[model samples]
Target: MLILPILLAFQTAEGSGYKTNDFALLGSDGKKYTVKTLTKGKPVFLVNLYDMEGSQGIADLNRLSQMTMGKVRVVGLTTLSTRGRGLARVKELGVRFLVLGSDDPYSILDIVPRLVIKEAGSVSYLSNTLLLPDRRLTHVWEGYNRWTLKRMSQDALKYGHVRLKIDFSRFPEKLQRGYGEFYGLGPG
Candidate 1:
C-alpha cells in the first residue's frame, strides 16, 4: 500500500520549497550573470533548452515576457551538448528575454541534484520551467506544455499585478521534455 502512494506521488505536480543557489555563468552577450543578479527583485524564469532545437518553448517564453511587460526575468539555459544554440535561436527569433550559452557549465552543478531530487519527490523543485523570484523556489515544471505556460501566465499576473490578455492560439500544442541542466565533461 505504501509503495502505491510513493509511485503516485511523483505522477502529479508536487509542491516546492527549494531555495536557489547563486553562481555566475557566462551569457551569450559575453557577460556574467548570477542567480542573484538576474533575479534581483524580479521573478526569474529558468527555461532549459534540453536539445537546443527551435522548440516552441522559446517562443513561449517570449510571449510570457510580453505578457509580463518586463516584470519578470526569463533566462534560457541550454544543455552543454547544445551550448551556443540558445543565443542563436534567441537572436533568430528576436526574443525579448535573455537566452544564455555556457562558458562554464559547472555553474549548474550545485543545483542539478536538488532539482533531480525534487522531481523525484524526495525533496523539491524540479523542471527547467523554474520560477525563482527570490532564492526560494516559486515553481518548477516538468514539461513545456500549454498548461505549464498558462501556469506561467498566472505567475506573471501575480507578479506583474496587471490584467493580461492571454491568447494561447500560437503556442505549441506538443509537450516538450525537461533536461537535466547538466553540463561540462571531464576526460580521464
Candidate 2:
C-alpha cells in the first residue's frame, strides 16, 4: 500500500467586517453588484458553472437551489456563449437564485483559485467556498459531489445559526441532492 499525505489548512471563523477583495458580479437584472454587499456579514455560497454538454453543473445548481433559502445566499456563475445563451441556460436549468454573467469567473476564482480543472481532453470546474461573516473562507468543497455538498450546506446552516439568523430545514429537497442523488451526476 502507498502512503498518501493529507494536507489540511486550519481556518478560523471571522467576525463582522467587509473587505475590498469583494468582487462585483453582473446580476440577473444586468446590474453590477458587490457580493460582499449582498452577503452583508452573512455566509455566502458562490458557485461557478459551465454549460457545454454535461449536466453536472445544472444538477448541482438544481440541488443547491432547492436546499438553500434564507440559510445562505447561493449565486450561480455561468459561462455561456452570449448574454442570451447564459440567461436562457439559467432558466432551462431551473436556477432559482440570482445568476451572474459569464464574465464573472474572477469572482469565483478569487474565492477558490483551484476551481477550474484543465485536463488533456476536457475541462472540469471545481470548488465552492463558503465565506464567513468576517470575509474568511470557512469551508470549501473541492468538487460537486452530493455528499460533500450536503455536508458543506449543512455546515453553512450550522454556522449561520451560530452567527446570523437562518433556517436550515427550510432549504429545499432539490438543494439536498448534493447529499444523495439517485441518478449519477452527468458527464464531465
Among the numbered candidates, top TM-score falls to 1
Q: Tell me the whole-model lDDT of each prediction, alpha carbons only.
A: 0.55, 0.50
- Clash pairs (backbone) in predicted model 2: 63-174, 63-175, 66-172, 66-175, 67-175, 146-178
Top lDDT model: 1
Candidate 1, 14-115: lDDT as tens digits = 344667666667666667777677766666667654335544555567776676555666676644422355566657766666665455543453554444
Model 1 steric clash pairs: 118-124
Model 1 misplaced regions, further than 4 Å:
1-16, 51-56, 81-96, 112-127, 156-165, 178-188
Error of 2 at 153 (Å): 3.6
